[model samples]
Target: MTAFTSHFAFEFRTGIRNKNLLLMNYLFPLGLYVMMSLIMPGINPLFQATIIPSMITFGILASTLLGLPDPLVQAREAGIFRSYKINGVPALNILLIPALSTILHILVVATIITITAPIFFDAPLPVNLPVFALIVVGTAVALSGLGILIGVISPNARLTVLYSQVIFLPSMIIGGVMLPYSMLPPVAAKVALLLPSTYAMNAFNSLAMGGTADFYAWGGLLTLFVGGLTAFILAWYLFRWDSQNTGSRRHPVLALLAFVPYATWLLIV
Candidate 1:
């Protein structure tokens, strides 16, 4: 536990020191909101009400999926993970540091969005704050698990970059961040439902639009719990702490199975 805490603190501080990462993890979502608000002036209220939550979700995705994975891949490639293993650090603890950092960053981003969004858009406060908080926390957990999976499995930095885009871009669009699922084509809407982001957006939209909060809230929670658990298990099996020594022990079967979530989304659509 001490090692985990120490490592988490070290990584957290390192993350804070990196100016570009700091801006991307914390401020980029808000910046996107500002840009969207300006571009859609007439729908400023909608942007504030709906888009803020979506952006919050996006922020969580970016921090975990985008920010954490590349570092882990690089660390593995450079033998940093081996050094930690030699020092008696548990494998889970090694991964936990970056995961915790990403979660903390997501919380900070969500809090900033919650506080600032209402002022700009005059959006109604969440009727069930506890439920809303749960959904946010759950979404972060799910995304972080996915991020860890990506970080562990990606063979190189270039592959991590490619996979990050492959995972995030379509998820963002179909996840209903840029537009409401209702406005999408039927196939697209069905596809969106399979992604964790879709449930997150539903939960957010419910809070913002005063719909059946219970449905979206519970839906988001379930998706987060189930999806995150499955991804974490797969990641644990496939992750190579010493990739250099593994010497071409590739698992194409596991790689294909990793796409099940996306494939499930297509089937639903």
Candidate 2:
């Protein structure tokens, strides 16, 4: 317990101390929130109604996708994980601590957006606050697992960026963050199902914000929970303490299994 607390505390502080993590965790998300708050409401006056959830979703993507993977890649490259293993730290702790800290940072940013959205921009609050919080935490856990999976499978920093962007950029454009899911073209809508942000937005709109879901809201939430569990399990199985020990783990392509829940949800839901 003492070791766990120490690791968690260090990772939490690292979220702030690392400049890129700090940017994704706080600056980029908040900046976009402010920018969107000032500019988006003018372009689409209805934007304020959903700004809180949308921007909060954006913060999660930036922090978990953009910020989380590179550090783990770097740490592994630097042999930090190898040292930890020699010193008796578990692989689960090595991954879980950083993910928890990142989630905490994301929630802090989410809280800021939630509180200030109404006061500063007249954004409508979630009618069901408890459920809204549930979805946020659910999305965080799901994405944090994805982040860890990326870190586990990606061999280098460059590939990590490529992997993260493959999800992040599309989410911003078509995952119901910048625009409503209903407004997307039919083909794009089908593609959007692959992204976690789409389910998040769908659940937030229907289950919490008192709006319609593009699909079954409860099923969407379940997809996130199941998807997160799958990703975390895969990441745990794939984790290596150092570059020298990659022979026994599953193929990196196996990481694609993380999307099984989302794809299955698309078919059944």
Candidate 3:
């Protein structure tokens, strides 16, 4: 436990030190919001109220997809993971440190977006704060789990960055961050339905607009949690502690389990 705490502390400090990462995770979402707000000035309030959750979702995606995976991959390539393994650190503990830290960073981003939405844009506060908080926390956890899976399977930082984009970009676009699911074409909307963020954004937008939050929003939270759990389980099986044998030994097949949550979601919705 003490070792875990020490590792967690070190990871937290490391994350704080990365200026570029801090900028992307902290400022990028706000910049997007600012640009969108300026362009849609007349409908800024409604837009702000509607898209704040989407922005927050984007922040979560940035933190988990890009933030956690690249560093872990770099560590593997740099032999840090081997050092930890030789020192007798538990695998789960090793993974948990970054997962927890990323979630913390995500929450900070969520808070910033939530508070600023109302003050700066005259956006409506969530009608149900508890529900909103639950969804946010759940979304953070699921996304972080996805990050772990990405980190474990990626052989190096470059592939981590590439794969992270492949997953994050599609999820963000289809999840309703860039546009509403309703506005998307039928096939795209169906694809969006498979992504957890789609439901999360839908729920959040509904709550912000002062309507009864759709059951799908809560369902989205559930789907994320379940999917994230599956991803972590698969990651445990596939996790690589070093770059050695990375290309030949990867268990990309196991990664498919991560999609179970989406499949379950199809059943629900």
Candidate 4:
């Protein structure tokens, strides 16, 4: 436990120093939230309430999808994992340390947005703070696993970034991050259902609005939990500590396994 804490701290410290990570993971999401809240047209108080949580989830999505993977891929390229293995550290611990650190940072970002959105936009605070916190933590776990999946499958830092963007942009547009579900066309709404970010928005928005969360919110949380589990399992199986793994068939196919839960939800919903 002590070793895990030490490693988690070290990863967080190192991540804070990376300018790219700082920009994409932390600053970009926060900036997007503030900017959209202030500048987006037709935003009323009620709309602003939902926007608060949705954008916080957006931060989690960006941080995990874009921010989390680069450092792991970079560490792989730098042979940091190899050094840890040679020092007799457990593989599972090494895999989880970076994720935990990333999740912690996302939580901090979420908290700041949650606290300030009300003041900035005259939005209502979450009716239930505890539920809001659960949604944030749950979303962080799911997104962090997806990030690790990207890190594990990507052979190099460049591809890791490329792959992250592939997931990020779509989620932002269709997953109800950039706009609400009611505003999207039917086809786009259906497409959004296939992405975990859509459910995250549904869940967070419900809790932020008030009253007991209905199926959309609770169901989203459950699906995200299952999706996170699947992504982590695949990441564990596919991860390579060596930087020399430059083969064409480096288990990139395994990334599809991360989508199974989302697909299943689409089928059921």
Best by lDDT: 2
* TM-scores, one per candidate: 0.87, 0.98, 0.90, 0.91
Clashing pairs in 1: none
Q: What is the per-residue lDDT of model 1 for residues 57-87, given as tens digits with 9 covering 90 to 100? A: 8888778777878888888988988898888
**Local distance difference test scores for all models:** 0.72, 0.91, 0.76, 0.79
lDDT of 2: 0.91
Better of 1 and 3 by lDDT: 3
lDDT of 3 by residue, 56-139 (tens): 888888888878887778778888878988999878887888888878777887888788878877766777888788778877
Clashing pairs in 2: none
- What is the TM-score (0 to 1) of candidate 4? 0.91
Q: Which stretches of candidate 2 lie over 4 Å from their true place?
A: none
The TM-score of candidate 1 is 0.87
Q: lDDT tens digits, residues 1-269, model 4?
A: 68878887888886677887787668898899888888763654445657667778788888899888887787788998899889987878777887888888888888788788888777678877887788788888888889998988888777887888877878888887777666778787777776778877777777655744324678788888888888888888888878686664645797888888787766665
Clash count for candidate 1 is 0
The TM-score of predicted model 3 comes to 0.90
Once superposed on the true structure, which residue ranges of model 3 sit more than 4 Å away at CA?
41-46, 207-209, 212-215, 247-250
Per-residue lDDT value at 114 in model 3: 83
